[model samples]
Target: IRAHHADLAKLLTSVKGVGPTTASTLLAQLPELGKLNRKQITALVGLAPMNRDSGTLRGQRHIFGGRADVRRVLFVAALVGTRFNPVLKAFYARLLAAGEPKKVALVACMHKLLVILNAIARSKSPWSNEIATVV
Candidate 1:
């Protein structure tokens, strides 16, 4: 994979917690990785939150309807990222500190991870702490 798609492989694997399988899944399953904007990419991956409001009753926001296979891979990556990736770790901590549920915080991290990856891919650059933080 590296020999054939060296640039992409490097870019995808630059982030912590993103291993061979995650990179491979992104490259193979999400061909539109770099081609789309942040919102577009997240929606495509089903990480974008969907509204669930009805009349005066406000329902809990939920994410649904996108690439399940990609979402599954991202879920694992995000879980690992919360522990290993500095940006994600900090973000997750902040969310939890703000009283967000574990599951909610993790899903937010997943969305963030995907956005960071999307930005890196779009910029055609390898991951960097500074860049990740900025994104």
Candidate 2:
């Protein structure tokens, strides 16, 4: 991958939690990562929350129906991110403090991590704590 997609590999691995395997998986499985908007990217990876409400019934928003493989890779990445990535670590803590369940917060962190990666890819930039925080 580095021989062919050096730029992408470098960009993806710039993030603290995204190792070579995670970056490669993303590059292979989610070719649209940099090309799409945040919403599109999240939906593609099954990280976007879907509304379950009906005409007269309010329901919780849940995620479903996207690339399970990408989602699985992101789950592992997010777990590491919560501990090592300062931005993600803070985000996870904040979510937990706000009463979100551990799993829910982790999912949210995954969503956020994807968004940050998408932004980085789109801008052709490497990850930085300041830039990631803004994203």
Candidate 3:
């Protein structure tokens, strides 16, 4: 995989917690990563929360229906991110302190991680601390 096109994969793996497997999974499963905006990318990865409200009753928002493989990989990556990646670690801690459920906070981290990855890919830049502050 590294021999195929090393730069993009290398750029992605520069992020802490995203290993070669996750990077390749991203390359194969999400060829559109760099081409789309945050909302579009998050929805594509099934990380965008969808509201389940009706006319009279408000329902909880939940995420569903997108690339399951990508979502799964992101979930795992986000789990590692909450421990190792500084920005993500801080964000996850903040959410937990605010009383968000562990799963909800992890999902939020997944969303933010994906958005930062999308932006990095779009810009053809290696991972940086600045991406952490975004979203």
Clashes of each: 0, 0, 0
lDDT of 2: 0.91
* Predicted structure 1, TM vs. truth: 0.93
Q: Write the per-residue lDDT of candidate 2 for residues 19-80, one digit (tens) a residue.
A: 99889899999989889989989998889999999999989999999999989989999999
lDDT of each: 0.90, 0.91, 0.90
Q: What tens-digit string does per-residue lDDT give for candidate 1 at 4-123?
A: 466887888889989889988898899899889889999998889999998998998899999999899889999999999999999999999999999999999999999899888888
List candidate 1 segments past 4 Å from native.
Answer: 1-4
Error of 1 at 68 (Å): 0.6
Least accurate 10 contiguous residues by lDDT in model 2 = 1-10
TM-score (all chains, Cα) for each model = 0.93, 0.94, 0.94
Q: Given candidate 1, what's the lDDT at residue 25?
A: 89
**C-alpha positional error of residue 116 in candidate 2 after TM-score superposition, expressed in Å:** 0.7
Model 1 sits at a Cα RMSD from the real structure of 1.7
User: Of 1 and 2, which scores higher on lDDT?
Assistant: 2
Scored against the true structure, residue 132 in model 2 reaches a CA lDDT of 86
